[model samples]
Target: MSNAIDFISAYNTIDSRLRAIYRGKGNLQFSDLVRRCAEFNNTVRKYEDDLLLCARLRNVIVHESKKDRIIAEPCDDLTRLIGHVAELLSMPPRLSVLREKNVTGIDAEATLAEALVRIAQTNYSNLPVYRKDRMIGILNNRRVVRVVGQALERGEDVDVFLQTPCSQILQAEDMNRFYRVLGRSDTVQEAIDAFEDNRKLLAVVVTESGDAGDRIVNLLTSADIPMLIRILEE
Candidate 1:
């Protein structure tokens, strides 16, 4: 609200939610913040600002929990969780060498089968699908089997079935603005959290000013973030 991006006193601006978040710093992930906060009455939703912030944190918690294969339900107070998320989201994202993504991209015109072969050769879980210099979407290795199975079911050519651009599968928009948006950070956790917060946002797109706006770089599930985290640690 101050337009200064200082969340240090964001709690002072809000109600008891700040207290809730401050109280639960032990469970640091986003979903836990939401789950813990959800246990509180609906009071969190009353503060529209706090509610929206908590929702984003919730997404982070849910996503990370799934990636780690944790059976956590994240039960904490909502008001506290909202404040924590507010502070966290206001901060810029962290980046890694993976975020550097020194890898080459594939053309959208490539056949699905060809792309699969390339992906296989590289041993990557996903490939960045690009239309020229612009990143379009991601081709996930896991989807190959499903595509093949569907091809077998429909009696269609897997090559043709998969020849389309990866944008067809980009759960978010393709934009240049997201490129390097995460910048550099002190920890992999910060970078991972940033990806969770903005991976599906307009920040993924490129604007007419040649800026990264509403742009998605490549799809990086919470799973990918951890891998980057590991790589960064090494």
Candidate 2:
């Protein structure tokens, strides 16, 4: 069959399989349901082996039909289509279990010298800076290194070459403010939103109940949030 035909057929098969599973093709015999697993799996496997569908099938199964009203179990077909959600489920957070040499700080001026030191010491391209419990800016390793060389050649004080604080660099005239902060007790999802959407990677991790949001117990860097999420999600 043509690529387009095969593509349509695959989607139809997924839809048909879901309809059969949930729409009560009225509860087949247990033995018959087991047989259905083999037949459905074989059908899905054929499409999975196709050149175009091999990779595309994974994405389709994952993203498509998510909101569709259907109840399906961990059948062989699903295993063939998705290939063990358990594998991805088990991937440890790249953030947690990562080295924590990058220590905590506040109002920390990111002189090029200091930024360079942190990058070299931590072997990370990004360094989080803070100003007395407030996240100030990220010291990018590449930029800091490049700007330091240029400043030094001119006999300039590299410390004076610090980039403007992150708020200044990322000020949003149109975007509304996000006062949505995490108390030390807040769920990790809050941290993820701040990191991904708010662009506040080195954002403040606050404690609300204690000191009534005045105290800063921890810092939530982009690195830390993802590490936590990897553990939670998988």
Candidate that would win on lDDT: 1
**Tens digit per residue, CA lDDT, model 1, 128-233:** 6677566555556545566668777999876577765455544442333232333233334444445555664322211223232323333344556557545433
**Model 2: per-residue lDDT, tens digit, 2-65?**
3333444444444445345334456554334434443433222233333233335434444563
Model 1 lDDT vs. the true structure?
A: 0.47
**Candidate 1, superposed: residue stretches over 4 Å from native:** 1-93, 96-99, 157-188, 194-234
| Residue 203's lDDT in candidate 1 | 23
- Assess every candidate by TM-score: 0.40, 0.33
What pairs collide in candidate 2? 107-130, 107-131, 107-132
User: Against the true structure, candidate 2 has what lDDT?
Assistant: 0.44
Tell me, by TM-score, which candidate is best.
1
